[model samples]
Target: MRRRKKKHEDEHMDESWLIPYADLLTLLLALFIVLYAASSVDAQKFKELSQAFNEVFTGGTGIMENPSPGETQPPSDGEVKSSGAEKEEKKEKADLDKEEIERQAFLKDQEELKEIQKKVNEYIKTNNLEVQFVTKLTDEGLLLTIRDNVLFDSGSAVVHSADLNVAKELSELLVMNPPRNIIISGHTDDVPIRNAEFDSNWELSVMRAVNFMKIILENQELNPQWFSAKGFGEFEPVGDNGTAEGRGLNRRVEVLILPRVTD
Candidate 1:
């Protein structure tokens, strides 16, 4: 009897590992189900799912808040209002910052242009060129006006050899830290002309501007790409073309220095 009892005890197999095995199988099955559901889950639901898994694996304390895949708790009225106010405030602040930056840039450009104008003014004063040359700072940019006769002979497109030094000096002043665009425009009086070299005042004005621009660009430091020439003949006059004095003012060339930034 003793031998038979011992044999029966030895025949019993150890089944203690089956508990942990069963637990592992249950965890794996849960993992697969959660992964499958995650495919169609919304943003809120995915967040909740992530928290749920974290709590389970970490053995932390939290109520398993497994809401439906598409269901989400909306914010209260007060929260909605606060969020909107915050967004609007942020937008206004951003706009103000942008405007301030633009303002600073415009002011900086204006200051630089003013310095350039001062230099040109000094040159004009030293040379006693007040009657022939004038400078104005306008919203568009700096305007340097010269009587046509100062640079060109009457009814001629060619720049006078005597005034080549003037153009060269102006070109030297134009060299700056940051170069700006320059335009040389020509204007003519109302008197009509049909010369051998020019068909009309229009042709004369255009050639005069082009020739002046060429002289300015002869300075190796000046970029030809930044210089352009145009003509407005007897149409966009600064003075009346009816009188001789007014006509003298009307027949002029303008050197316009444009601002790098504008309002």
Candidate 2:
């Protein structure tokens, strides 16, 4: 036996530690998967992870059961609902603030218009031109309506020399604000016209407006760029064409002091 010695049987050590190493590797893989799921916001993946964790830790218990030990619960439904409601409230408040700003601006414009109306009315009273020209504040801004008789004779487009001072007074008023808009519009009675200079009422009305605009421009202080002229022959009548008085009322010129938009 000693001679043989079984060739001093080759000795081997036990490798039982491999089982624990394998288990550690498996746990690390599971941990990495859980960490990835936690960082993501995908609801379906989260549900799958929850079910897998339940199977692994709780022996396949309900999917809603907690998998980790001493872990705090996820956000409650009430918390999520409260977050959405807060966002809605913030939006509503911003909208209301914008509306309030617009309202204040509107009020300020209204006050300014009232002051302009007062000044214009006083001027008309002072000059005793109330019958021929009248001023008023409207939504479209300050309006000055002039009877055709005051600016022209019969079917002519010429500005009467007597009314030239009216243009001067208007130009003086606008010189205070050079950028203010002055829109002159002419209207004529419904009756058709045959003339040597103008073919129809449309031409006569337009020329009438242009001539008056020229008179206002003679001041040289007013900005010509802010002036515009338009004509509505018999189309935009202000009175009935069947009566003489109504026809007189229909033939007129209007000057609009346009309102400015406030920021």
Model number with the top TM-score = 1
Off by over 4 Å in 1: 1-63
For model 2, residues 47-140, the per-residue Cα lDDT tens digits are: 6788878788778787445444324457779998999999999999999999898888777776766777777778888988889888877778
Worst 10 residues of 1 by lDDT: 60-69
Error of 1 at 97 (Å): 0.7
For lDDT, the strongest prediction is 1
Extract clashing residue pairs from model 1. Answer: none
Candidate 2 segments exceeding 4 Å error: 1-80, 176-178
lDDT of 1 by residue, 105-203 (tens): 999999999999999999999999999999999998999999999999889988899999998998998887678899999999999988789888888
TM-score of 2: 0.69
**Clashing pairs in model 2?**
none
